[model samples]
Target: VKIRVGNGRVKGVDLGYKVIECEKIVVAAGEGSKYLFQTLDIDIPIVIRRKELYVSEPYSLFIDPLIIDTREDSLGLYVTQTLRGELMGSIDYPEAIDDLTHETTLKHYTVYAKKLVRLIPIMKYSTVMRCWSGNYVTTPDNSHIMGRDPEWPEGLYISTGFSGHGFMLAPYTGFLMARHLIYGETPNTMEPYTPDRFRMGKYVRESLVIG
Candidate 1:
């Protein structure tokens, strides 16, 4: 995918086989945003890390709210029961990798299982129905990048690098971003997350990132 910019403004996007003309563009392509921005000579401070998660077989409802185990030994493990009674969660400890691969490793599974059983003893008997791996698009400060930059091409906006909180922060961020694009005004709440913060050495540090 190529973002076609002309006259210092977004003109369209070229998707290899076809081109879609547009006046504005919002880049929210997760890990792929790095390469997408590079087409326009823009380099974002985004890093990709590998995250693994597991789900246990359905059991009688036991756990209610999500349990965040921040014990030093647990490595920020979180566990929660889904509506279907399946236990689902992941550990906050992630592995930094360069490639985009969803390959699960036995080492990760073993570590996660031991930690889960240690935190919830009853989980020792539960069978892990499945496990999967995914990528976390992170930034130095662990917060998302939103809004636009005056130095960037006009009509070009960014909303990526949520670190691990994209799903949780999407609704509010999306709303604010929409208002900023439509009204040509950046909201006070979204001011701290402009794409130029990295260059400006302004970071919004967050420490409580749990799975």
Candidate 2:
């Protein structure tokens, strides 16, 4: 996909061979968003990281409800027994050595095993069937970046830098993004999350991010 800017305004985007023209563009490209914006000479302050997860084979139902460990050292270690009787979870750890690969490590397994076993002793016996990793889009403040880019071509909006809470906060983010883009409704609550804040050295750091 390619962005199209012309005549001092965004003309929409070029999707492969097709050009889908529009008045505005909302770039919610997650971890790749920084690169995407760079093509247009806009700098997004985002850091790319990787997170790992593990899943257990089906077993008899025992534990319920999503368990979250809110300790600072293990801020996002969470585990839950799915309805299918499988236990699934992940833990927050230092960023991977390589930021571009979804490589899983024994370190993730070893650390998560210790945390899960402490929460649910039966997890010690549960068979871990599979593990995987994915990318995370982080920011200096760990909060989101929203609204239009003041220096970019007009009609460009960004709603990324979600850290790791994008899924949980999608509905709210979508709502604010839609209203801000379509209606020019810039609420006072959103002032703290603008990308310009980073340029001005103002950060709204959040400490509750999960893995």
Candidate 1 local distance difference test against the native: 0.88
lDDT of 2 at 63: 73
Worst 10 residues of 2 by lDDT: 92-101
| Runs off by more than 4 Å, candidate 2 | 69-76
Per-model CA lDDT versus the true structure:
0.88, 0.83
lDDT of 2 by residue, 1-211 (tens): 7788998899988888899999998999887788778878777888888999888999888777788987766637898888998888998775663287788899878988988888777678778999888887888889999887577788988888888888888898898888898789888778789888987888998987768
Each candidate's TM vs. the true structure? 0.94, 0.85
For model 1, the stretches where C-alpha displacement exceeds 4 angstroms are none
Clashes of each: 0, 0
lDDT of 1 by residue, 118-158 (tens): 98888889998999888889888998999887899998999
